[model samples]
Target: MASGNRPVLTVTGLKKSYRSAGEDIAVLRGVNLAVAAGESVALTGESGSGKSTLLHLIAGLDAADVGEIILDGVSLSELGDAGRAALRRDRLGLVFQQFNLIPSLTVADNLTFQSRIARRHDPKWQEELVERLGLARLLKRYPEQLSGGQQQRVAIGRALAPKPLLLLADEPTGNLDEDTADEVLALARDLVARTGCGFLLVTHSARLAATLDRQINLHAGVIA
Candidate 1:
């Protein structure tokens, strides 16, 4: 744990299970962790170690069967479905491997979409992110017009536009080649630092994990 630091995220005895067929599959078992503001933590695990499930729970997209997830001092269990959604929109930024951009919207529109929805739209910040992400030249181009790497860059720009308190990325560079992945991760790290937000990156690449401030490995759903 980092002393003298304000925690942006705190998880205590987090657990989750799923009903698969006739059996209950326990995914996470008593996992506890904390992430400090402006810190970057890399989470690595085997495919079925429940990495994505843990991320979903932390993101408020899914409920945990047991344990507490506190983000910025608010407990996720205390928030109703709508409240969680609002919290996510207002205080959290997420980037997925799929690069979920609006196909019909231009790059610029896609970039500022979430911030606009969250009512935290800052034109100056958005402009800076666009320039930093190299999306300034492709503002008018649709997602379909961009390559995979380009779309991912747009996705990163979109997540960063809101200046959220925490950013969650699930294998954000999974769709890119090694060289491009490194580039994108570097850009993400730089932006996260400039924004002064905490970051949790779920990845399998040891090389990539080494670049972060700390690495947390999940074994059978528990931090090892």
Candidate 2:
């Protein structure tokens, strides 16, 4: 892990609810958490435990009903739509269970897409990611041309290409086999350490959760 004691992300007094059938369904209630630079955390929760809702709020995809999220010292509540969008583009790395690679682009292009658009592209760093992710020989292939594991690797590389301050993954390996999931996650953790970025992963696998530096379970709208 890189040297740093400062937290890359922090959540305080977070609360959210949704109205359903004339009733307000509470999701997250006063949830507080923090992820320090170079630290990896796993969030485990049953379905409807609000894991994805919390992530959406943190990523600025949706607004929290109450409380705040601080990303690299910038408060999410303070940012406008444009600001949030810009932050997401430039400072946050996000990966989902689905390997959302561009089908039209080759592996090299897919890997560099976000960095290039954000104007944060670093040739050296990009090369290092390609090498570390074992994607060098597959650079010429497109997303459909690769296997599930390979495509996921490319997705991870693309997310980390710009060296974001925080990485949020929602069941990133949900579609892969156990062995492949472990391998992919190992690569992700190694890269997170290399970048000194805070990592927050949501997974259902208790075994996978155990590999993280810390594990927290969400239950009944709060961290349990």
Q: What is the C-alpha local distance difference test score of each model?
A: 0.93, 0.94
Q: 12-103, model 1: which lDDT tens digit per residue?
A: 99999999999999999999999998899999999999999999999999999899999999999999999999999999999999999999
Candidate 1 RMSD computed on C-alpha atoms after optimal superposition onto the true structure = 0.8
Leading candidate by TM-score: 1
TM-score of each: 0.98, 0.97
- The lDDT, on a scale of 0 to 1, for candidate 1 is 0.93
Which parts of model 2 are misplaced by more than 4 Å? 1-4
